[model samples]
Target: MVHSSDVCQCESFIRYEKTFGVTHFYSIEGVPRTGPTNVTILNITKHSALVKWTEIAAEDRLGFLQGYRISYTDSSRKKSPAVTLNASVTSYHLTGLKEKTTYRVQISGFTNAGEGPLTLSQPFSTPKYDKGELEGFVIGVCFSMTLILVFAPLTCCLVIKR
Candidate 1:
């Protein structure tokens, strides 16, 4: 008879033969396991990045994924808090962001199994506003055009009367 401790570490079976008996042993290993799959990010904007990932593996006995953790750093090297999202949710909007600032973002999925690798997004900048002087210049030009149009005809009429 083959003993449990007699099994080879290489997973090879050991067979013992005797004059009137034979013993056989089978070695098996656990199935290979995989974590989350098809993880991706989308709908990226100046203030937020949306993340999408496939369901956990069928063999995965881990509980439902709690949420995603989103982290970011601004151009000035300022770090922001980790943004959390629900397991059922695949999208979120980050608001109150500054305009014309560059931001770098990363995301990862979390569950009882563990946290996944952080997926990074391209650096993006928020939309910038028009210069105040430029806007004032446009307004002034419009006002001058309106005044000329209003008085041009009156001036011509007075000249003809004289």
Candidate 2:
């Protein structure tokens, strides 16, 4: 036999068996009842990004939080394992990403209860790496080297190294 009751919309279950004559009870305990909010991406780079999110509501969270879990997928459709972090942390840095590719990300808050609903999905793209000043320097050096190679031989023929 099984008996169920609803308290504050939370479910409680009781089970009993006639043959074995045993009873068991299960119910929710102190834990976070809702998911975190306001997940955002910041400080994007060619191979990494910083993610931030709001904390769970105070009342909904019983006392201490376990942590958070983050999941991400890239243009290649490869899924990443949920990254876990301490409860005190709100920002996380994701690394090892392909340049100029968009990654889809989702986050969820967890506590003693379990993982809550995932946040609304968000997509962010890594920008291409820039070698601005280095590129210009290389071009200038090449031009100077070419000029030396051309002028040095002509000058050498006129004013012999003898």
Candidate 3:
């Protein structure tokens, strides 16, 4: 005879019989649990962004988390390709992007089974470029001052010699 409490924790559920004066235990399957949750974008910049999130659940401790998927849309409302990352990777760098462009980013956590829902960020724009006209004026003023400094001393020396 097999007692109920005698069942092993390794076995989800056990079944036993005494038809042949002997008992046999069989393991049953268990339901799979949900993956991680609460994904969010932490920060963004001109050429890259930083994403942060928390892991809420896992199917099993022995199971491996696959990665995350990052999706984004540009100012033109065109969606970009999905970027895949490792499970342990909470943040990522998105490079080679135009300056002063608006973007919407979302993050989704994933495991071997499936991916969690996407967490999106508010509409954000990259840092604006330096103003060209203002920069040019500043450069012109500096150049004029440098030329004056170069000629002023020679002009004074010539006046003294005369």
Candidate 4:
């Protein structure tokens, strides 16, 4: 199901850049302004980092904001995967980070116009891995077992008519 709000306002035209010649144009709309006036790393877990940020002022958005591109780098690679998020979303969790590793993060927005400014964040490191001990493992198994015990009987009764 699609909603009216989800429908985008778009147009098509060929425009020439100052340096480059005419470029292909299709489905062009207004684009967001410089993204993320403030890029903050809220928390750094052993294998993840939680990032939060506020968007640029509305006036900066020349066109409607479609979404954002969040990128960061760690020790293993010079570049990280770009995560695309909705414009309304102001926070995100970055997973698969290395333990006790620092990373440089950047945030940019995209609109009908194109990609906006990239806000490079200060280097931040993931937290050291802490052995959670048997407490977490035991609790997880117990929880799974409880659910299976409760559902297994109902599933068997429905499947095998005795």
Candidate 5:
């Protein structure tokens, strides 16, 4: 026998009838209601980048938080390997990336229940090679070639005169 008033007043509950009798289960366990906030990229470089985000609020995380999941894709739309971070980690450093390429990243919180909704993908571009270092190498090579062109002929003429 069951009545509306007899139901447990919990945030969430389940009721069922077994072979023996009626039973009720109550639990607050659920996936996070909202994704991480303030997702930002920093310290972008030729081959690496740093990503950070705010943690899900306590009230929003309905279950025991286990960790976070990060997914990224490059401009070519190829998905990179997803990363899972500890619950205490609010930032991550991505590595082994191509220079001057654009990437999009998304983050979501996971609990004992499952992964929550993902944040909108955030985009960032890696920096290209440094021009100053390349220019210096080119200049050094040109100077060495000029010296060889001038000195080689002079040395040959002196040897012929001898």
Candidate 6:
């Protein structure tokens, strides 16, 4: 039985008084015991990265699973808004990232009670963008193809007329 003063501001938990004026806490809706595991961050491009992780085990999720929160920041320590995904999501593509930068990402699950603990941050690095190299390769291929197309037909005609 709960008394008037026994209930705390957060209804999920209650504080009750015992003998000798001692207080004890009890949980009605427990949060997850641990964060998600097997978190992986892979850089897919200079401006984006892919994040994937396994969900928290059923036993650890003490309440209804709402979703997962992903927090990421670059080496400069600039804070970015966290992305929240539904519980069904296991993979996410993070865009608008800086090129050739190192970033750290952390993941955690949440429920009606609140967010659970965050996993250890994992580091990933984006590759540098070099447009010149790609452009040069494309231009070279187009030029070689144009030359072959022009010369091959003319050579066949000349040999047939001989």
Cα TM-score per model: 0.49, 0.63, 0.53, 0.59, 0.69, 0.65
- Cα lDDT of model 4 by residue, 1-162, tens digit: 111232233434224313334233334455564677777887677788788888767667766778889988887757987999988998899988888788888899988678888886657887665357457888899999999999999999989986
lDDT of each: 0.59, 0.78, 0.62, 0.76, 0.86, 0.83
In the predicted model 2, the residue pairs found to clash are none
> For model 3, which pairs clash?
none
Per lDDT, the best of the predicted structures is 5
lDDT of 1: 0.59
Candidate 1 RMSD to the correct structure? 12.2
- Write down the worst ten-residue block by lDDT for model 1: 24-33
Q: Give per-residue CA lDDT, model 2, range 1-162, as digits (tens).
A: 223443333234333312434433334445466667888999888889999999887665654578888999998989988799988888899998888899999987776767777778889998876346558888999999999999999999989855
Which residue runs does candidate 5 get wrong by more than 4 Å? 1-26, 130-162
In model 2, the Cα lDDT at residue 110 comes to 75
Query: Considering every candidate listed, which one attains the maximal TM-score?
Result: 5
Model 4's alpha-carbon lDDT is 0.76
lDDT of 4 at 115: 89
**lDDT (Cα, tens digit) per residue for candidate 6, span 1-162:** 112234235644436523345343335556778889999886467889899999999778877778999999899999689999999999899999988898999989998889999999999888776446678888999999999999999999999999
RMSD of 5: 10.4
lDDT of 3 by residue, 90-117 (tens): 6667766667898887766665546766
lDDT of 5 by residue, 1-162 (tens): 112135455544444522345443326578888889999999888899899999999777877778999999999999999999989999999999898899999999998889999999999998786446668988999999999999999999999999
RMSD of each: 12.2, 11.7, 9.8, 16.4, 10.4, 11.2
